[model samples]
Target: MKGRILLVEDDETFRSFLQTVLEEAGHDVLMASDGLSGARLIKGQQFDLVVSDLKMPGKSGLELFRDAMRDADPPRFIFLTAFGTVEEAVGAMKDGAFDFLTKPLEDPDALVRVVDRALEGLQRSRDYLALKESEAGGLPPEELIFAGSAMQPIRKLVHNVAGTTANVLIYGESGTGKELVARTIHLLSPRGGGAFVPLNCAAIPENLLESELFGHEKGAFTGAVQARLGKFELAKGGTIFLDEIGEMPVALQAKLLRVLQERVFERVGGGKEIRADVRVIAATNRDLAEEVAEKRFREDLFYRLNVFPVNLPPLRERRDIIPLLTEYFIRRFCRLVGKKLKGIESEALRAMKAYTWPGNIRELQNVVERAVILAQDTVRAVNLPDALVGAGGPAAAGRDKLKMVERDLIVQALEQHGGNRRQAAEELGMSRRTLQYKLKEFGLLG
Candidate 1:
């Protein structure tokens, strides 16, 4: 979507170049040379996002952000800094900058993409703000689909607690928008302006999770050829959302607790301690209280993170939200695949309502996205996976519940044809676009 942009910089040539580039991308551009003038323009204007040079004649970007936020609605700021001044830029990001670009600006394309992303962020916040005010209460809970009385208490809870910088422990079934809630907290909190880094504890191997969180010095391990910065250092003053915190190994739990308490961690095989002022937001599908009582999880760390607890009900529990979620996913996935199907058919909706989603919202999203991708024309119940089609097939939809799994047998034939879609399609008993579309659909986009 197109939106307004304000660039605050002292250099005339750079300012002119940016304005021209941004305008060509279909954005309305506004410019200011110094911080004082920039502040005045920002306070008076309704900009989607702001890009400003860090160092200026009068006030700096930091001063401008401080002043601009005084207004009820302040545009998100992106700082511009030089290469040697990255430290200052990081400080700005921690202070509330959306994302920063370094000078001399090398990648015009990257800059445009960053601006677009920032604009999308602005739109989401604006939408959430409007929805929270217009609706019964605050914005809907993360990964939660429902309506009416059931959502009010959760909405009020989310709104009341989001402002605090305390460590938050979220309890929810898998795919319940735990990360989304973590993100909403970051978006609405004092640390909302900083980076919101996320890590899946279950995804990472136990041996690697520590190094991933705390970084590693060069040659610390067999494959350690470079000194790598960890997630905590990268997040700094923002937030680190540890998804599936319960899955973390028992040994690493001690270190994670120390980091949570002291905000300090040592790189793998390094002596120096790195202090991060970052906020901790941990989420788990398992019952941490049970884990604590069973002596599996560290009581200290659990307490530290459990300062503010937010629990999200499973999709089945929040039955009211199913319709909303179904519509949202259909629209979202259709857009992703470059399709324009209207809404779900009544039969499809009925099938979805009847299914018990064990994998929860994520499972629902994948099913909808895959159904859209597989559908020949508009969405229909017949287009869904075979497992989802017949109640006799499976107990419930397994993961995505694909109707057909593409075997390596067909893929082998396709490769034997030297990447010729026509030959592959003829051999595989399909059309060229159908084969080509499958390849493209499976992330083989070229």
Candidate 2:
């Protein structure tokens, strides 16, 4: 994507020419006549990339670089040096300069390539900061696992909403990976370079929850020794992910609604109006409509938060993606504990496939990670926990019974090869199946 660039140069003729070149190259360029003007303009304007001269009056390019870092989100900087000094240029780069262009302008292609790389770094910085803000200041979604077709629309919605400061409400089952979704959206957005503040409405006590969301002034309450900015204030220009938002008190919900609608709030004990530029992504598992009808949840607050509802499906329906998720977790856990597993066994895979995971992907992840950790050597079928064979639900419960029914046939093969199923199954075990069927009437299997 083309990015906005703030170009600072003292030479009028050169500045005009460079602007035309960048414009023709599909970049939106803002030209400032001097470094001081450039720094002043940067305070009000948000640019993705910055190109400034090395030496200028009022403030030098290096000084401007320091100032840019103080903004809500700073731009990537490229230095233009007319009387280039190696020491100064190197210093500029060490101070976060994207690149330095010498007095003798070389290939414009090289400049374009530098700009592209700088923009990528800018994007990475943006994404990191945004995810951080959400993680630190919001009601973070706690579940790390996600499932169901519900995610497809959620993904698209995140892509659309990440660019703006709109409040979002995500609805799903408890283990539905709502926080991960919110973080994903924040990372994909332009504000991804900001903080991601998270809070759990249900976890905090009702009395302290409001103060946590909107900080109290010093000495405002019994423990109010220091003034503090709340989650919304801390997450300014980024995202605030409110997890289990349905659990918020009715009175608190009104205040939350005001913050969403007016982009303003007051400290718990202070009357100062704080303008909130923070994006909100709230999640809940409760049926909000029923809660509203029951008078447990505020109807106005519910309406305010119900901007976009994303419902995640339970694991049973999306069986197709199970294997993919299984591998994703396997690789993650294996690397975490410092092991390299080749793969799983056929019978074991079948056992897992038959399971009806009530706890969903989270349950599956724990089971797999446990299996990987318990394995004696390279992870395989036997390495799989015996519990997985009979854990989870009905399918697991029935697996052992079915195996008992298949046992005599297993023994016949084991016997044929002098107690080795490998040889016996390759030879007379097929005949043993016939004999074993009649033996089945005698009820001798495992």
Candidate 3:
């Protein structure tokens, strides 16, 4: 694997000789006269590997290595030492040097061999990462919309880790756009060219989820008529987004952990082990820490998936985004529904901003879509839900009143029906599904 390499040696002749050999082997080599110069070069540029003398006048090779290690993606290091300093060279190896060489270079080809092996390993790693990224295509960073300080850190974290192979766990309340964050990470990463496969663990039935994740052979189960590929297989060389991961069954969590640990898994009722080349991004609204403490989740699995955790701020906390989101949704729905709406009315924007968004971005989206359909020209207060605008007070402060009213109505309905969903739906004059959906939306499922 040909790569840009940094060569640090105080001896001018030796440095020139090494640079000649490396360049002949089709590798671009940068020469540094001393350890300090090498360290400076590394900080200013990206190198695949660093070859430096063990001893230097200023900033010894070991010191340079220590400094380089502070970077998020440090270059691989190879140290050169004299005959009597082999022990010290070995010690450098212990400090994470790629490999160490002795002075008075014998069989000059040995250096080439070590360089080849190191470059080969680096190539394989890049290939694996590239395979994943190529399959999971993503949106550009500028395409993601958010106008709140709360999201700045989250966006920065996404950018920082996108180029690496770290597994990410996204924590947020329902409707907080956890899946959106996952897609954003996948798009921004090196593996953006790959597919972004998403599966909601809570939405699937317990019996079918396993097959959905790991596939099944013909006649594997009662209804199995033919062999089928699973999400992991379909998402090969890309990303598999597991949504509502906290709801994954404990029995299945063990299997998921094994796949993560070994990077291999067998399809349901299949004997052959299949290699899993996909990156797994899991998200959930529930607190996995609490779930682990209560034995509902596996502690080991939690740690494995939580290598990098991103927490999304709730809609109520990032109220500043409401107007932007409102406007965005307005334009989006207007185009879709062929509405001639010019813009959102000031009163409508104030009402939306004041209303505590229990349903988050998803709720805001739904409201805007509904408003677009009802709007004749501009979205006004009348186009919004009565719950948002009917409260007596400045529209901005009326969110609390709306919340209180909604809570009281739900509580009364539940009490009237003794918590029976069917009767509650009938009494509330709404579909049972709508009632259940609202119950979940309002955080009353408990």
Best by lDDT: 3
The runs of at least 3 residues in candidate 3 whose Cα sits more than 4 Å from the true structure, single-residue gaps closed, are 1-144, 391-446
Give lDDT for model 2: 0.74
TM-score of 3: 0.61
Candidate 3 all-Cα RMSD: 12.4
Per-candidate TM equals: 0.59, 0.63, 0.61
What's the true lDDT of residue 49 in model 1? Answer: 84
RMSD of each: 19.1, 15.1, 12.4
Q: For candidate 2, write residues 1-446 as lDDT tens digits.
A: 57899999998988887787788778999989998899888988889988888888889888999889877667888888866465787787887777988865667776777888888777876565555654454322222233345456656666777676566788665555677777787777766757878999999999999999989899889988999888988999888999998889988888988997888999988999999888888998766786797788999888877776676665655565667677666777777888888766666666677665656677777778887897655456565656666554576557657766666666665676775433665565366334433333333433
- lDDT per residue for candidate 1 within 203-298, as digits (tens), equals 999889999999999999999999999999989878899998988888999999888778788999999989988988899977677668667798
Ranking by lDDT: 3, 1, 2
Using lDDT as the measure, name the better of candidate 1 and candidate 3. Answer: 3
Evaluate all candidate structures by whole-model CA lDDT and list the values in order. Answer: 0.78, 0.74, 0.84
TM-score-superior candidate, 1 or 3 = 3
lDDT of 3 at 90: 85
